[model samples]
Target chain A: MTSSTERSERAGAPAFALPFRVGRALAFHELRERTRDRWVIVISALFALLASAVGLYGRSAEGNAAAITGPSLVTLASLFVPLVALALGYDAIVGERERNTLGLLLSMPVGRTEVIVGKFVGRALALCLAVGLGLGAAMLAAAPGEARTLAALLGPTMALGLAFVSVGLLVSTLVSRQSTAASVVVAIWFLFVFFYDLGLLAILVATEGAIGDELVSSLVVGNPTGLYRVSLLASLGGENALTDLGLDVSLPSASARGAIWCAWIFGPLALSAAALSRRALR
Target chain B: MQRLTLEDVAVRFGRIEALRGTSLELRAGEVFLLAGPNGAGKSTLIRVLLGLVAPTRGTLRVDGAPVRADRAFRARLGYLPESVAFSESSTGREVVSFFAAARGAPKKRIDEVLERVGLADARSRLVRGYSRGMRQRLGLAVALVAPCELLVLDEPTGGLDQDALTLLWSVLDEHRAAGCVVLLASHEIALLESRVDRLGLLARGQLVALGDPTSLRERAALPVRVKVAPRADADRDALVQALERVGTIAPVRGARALELDVQPSRLLELLDLDAAHRACIADLQIVPPPFDEVYRRLLSEAA
Candidate 1:
């Protein structure tokens, strides 16, 4: 459709649309392919089951239907979302480069930023579908009342997935091999989810809880996982999930948590896009 | 005017020069064959043309404008990398469709290209199950998803069978007929002979020769080899003496025959030499120097 008029119209179109089209198309295709993958299938099923189990527990419990004890589903999400996100995105760029397909892609009209953006969108969408449906099923089983009760933790949990996908994208661009990228993502996931919080706890106790609420909130916001835990604990205003569990940790304001989540999602993604465009791309 | 021009392009990887002062121009309706041994910067050249690798020095222009700053200029180019590997989960149709979408091409173009590449039958099959040749053809389909002003194929025929090879040639023929410039880099000499409009012999990242096949042969100035066997080993000296009347004759160390370097101009005269020279009294082999020989000699000389 490179007719004289069509070409002129395309020229007149917003210059920004070109990169968006490339990224969107890539994301669409990535999503289509990932949806068919057995790994995605397994993970999605597991998430649905876990979310449904949480919802069912909440429904059967004495807590009001909206959620039970500060959306315990956040804990499950902390475990599964990153795992799924890592699987979807850890190899997005470097994998293509390693396989020699990245050259073929760059040879097209698409730019490097577009490719990275496309990959991020693809992985994010795939992750969203899995975690959203699973968690929705959980809430449905729990019949979580108004959807408002789960809002704080749900956003942060999904943001955590996006953050890890961004992290995975960054890893994909920086590393040269798929296996290496995958390992780095796994190691980072372990640190963020399992180890980082444990170390945070040990420090808090060793220092005799001398850390102020602001310091504790700052430290928690530093890690998306810890941010997710606080969002859930804070959202349970009545249940006092944190105090009941002896956590007694201070949580950041909504605006601050929102900033942290946005940073988690967008920061690594921006870096990934920049690094890929700068890559030598042999 | 040249459809594409690379002026004094030098690509340095760290301290190593992958492409050194390689300046060349290509025109529409020309099939440019880039023949060099492995690591002679053939792939690097194609990568630069595709704008995949930024040249460390000099400039590359397409249609009279520097394309490095205008990444969008690459829309008019199609490139098939040496080895194409896609996500294993994607079917051939999905792979081609993704490329087609990326190129902003029509959905129908995917089927057309796949059918043209003989991959239509396998389009529904996952690429993980594809053989090396099938994957290459899939790559070709991706490159052909849209019309291109310039087509750059790196080692296009490495894993292709005879049928695929024929298809590739025919496709190149069509592209040339449509006045598309095609840059083909391959070690395979078979695609170099008559199909190539211009053969570029690259060695050590420099373009040593850039001309038609016939002109390159003429430039090489290689002599035609005439191997002769005397009726008996004792008759070889007599045959050598007579053959020297036409051109240089050297003894084959292990054979009863001697190898004579026949000048192209003196070939007819040598044929007219007395049958009694007895050098060909048993068997004869007239070896005309072709492109491969010229290619080998150029690379060795560069080394």
Candidate 2:
């Protein structure tokens, strides 16, 4: 029998020698799989073409002096950014578990943290590459002066995309099966992007301008997409343009600031990673 | 000897107690077969040991240290889940490599195990196209690639022909010779009888029996069959006393006149002695019940 001291030594055994390295290895494995998937390539091309068309249309309209305002572009980005995020992240966790690869990954020396974090990073990287392709296509589609617009919106757009992906990963872990998770994520998409905004509009109409100060600010802060839309508006319409447009374009709030916007994007991403890491494999 | 232990282990799914008050120890170089039918808690037990499921009420330890939170404990253990699945839509080679990377096996060893499992030629083909037997072989390859201290296999040979079964047994034999502790859970009793050194029979989350194969068969209390013809002044009472000393036996019934069922292997000595004295003038047969009867009888009686 082992002594108490020996028991303690074994109790304090280091997590593993290769959890992080293996996580990175898994990340690369995910990348290889993602890159080889015909769907990813197809979606990448589609997003690129779509972003390119939007960019070209914006540039042509600017030349003709019939352009959509900077705030309008923010609204436009809001429409599609969450779609991409939800589509990719929703299946990230549940699909692996459904396909039975999650068990294989969990059986390794690595902890649950590694598997979740690694997959998040891997999926995020795939999204980045896909969005980058879209941005490249946007660049080619730009006419003369729209390169500045693309540059200004690029980082913020990618950050918003990452935030959505994190949310999807979180939902994936929370649910059991792939089909159920996918369905819930889609419902979440409808609620957040479509219905929630519509409800907010109803609230705005009832409250009118009297309650706009505190309530409008709180609502915008609570919604990451609204915050991102506001940020993108500022990038397009000059810094003080949101203040000038009043609630018509975006709300003004203490937490609606740019730093808070960054936090909104990173918060869920961090939480999803944490949840995935800390939760045990079923 | 290194020991793997579970203390007051319990697993529950909502209100259902999949495993309750389950605790056992496995030692290095011992082939411990966990025999149970479906829903007998064998799968749940194996999952807990593999670190896939946390025990609701107790702790899991390796060498006397808690492994519930020990990630490295997994590295020392190799697992073959009941139904193996792979991502990347990969060929057999890629699937094996993924497991090798997870287990920290040497790059060269991956190829060796693939060849050992008879998947060397099919290594380049996508696993999506593999047959059930080939996939099972691949699963075995994954479990064998690493130098794990403990190997936990759930139905390792669930789908295999006799030839494929031989290949798996051979691989297990190699692991045995190398002194690896193997904990296998299977409903296939005939296969496990020869493969495992000890058999653990579980029913409704309780360990009803655990011992070497012969000991288990003996403890099962099911009579072993023996036949003999009637003899003149044959000390029938003495024969009955001698057989009763060995184990419980049935009365003389059916065609052969005097037929007794005793301990599986113990009857041989009595028969040998009787033959030496020129007693058994007919034929002999040893019939054993299928292993499931051990659980069927106990579970039913308990209920």
> What are the per-model DockQ values?
0.50, 0.28
Task: Give the C-alpha miss distance for residue B3 in model 2, angstroms.
Answer: 2.1
TM-scores vs. true structure, each candidate:
0.89, 0.82
TM-score of chain B of each: 0.86, 0.81
Which candidate should be chosen as best, given TM-score against the real structure? 1
Model 1 chain A poorest ten-residue lDDT run: A7-16
> Candidate 2 residues B1-303, lDDT tens each?
377887878898878788888788887778889987678899788778777777789887777877663565676677887777665377888877766665566678778989998999999988888888998888888887776668888888788889888997886787677677788888887767878888777888887777887776566666666655546556655655555665665665444355666656576566455553346244445667766675566456545
> Candidate 2: which stretches are off by over 4 Å?
A1-19, A36-42, A58-76, A239-262, A273-282, B12-14, B56-61, B64-69, B225-285, B298-303
| Consecutive 10-residue window with the lowest summed lDDT within model 2 chain A | A64-73
Q: What is the CAPRI rating of model 2's predicted complex?
A: acceptable
lDDT for model 2, please: 0.71
Poorly placed runs, candidate 1 (over 4 Å) = A1-19, A60-70, A143-154, A205-211, A237-239, B63-65, B227-241, B244-261, B275-285
- lDDT by residue for model 1 (A36-149), tens: 868778987998897787777776676763346345677788888888888888888888888898887777777777788888888888888887787677666765473556
Instruction: Please state the Cα-based DockQ of model 2 relative to the true two-chain complex.
Output: 0.28
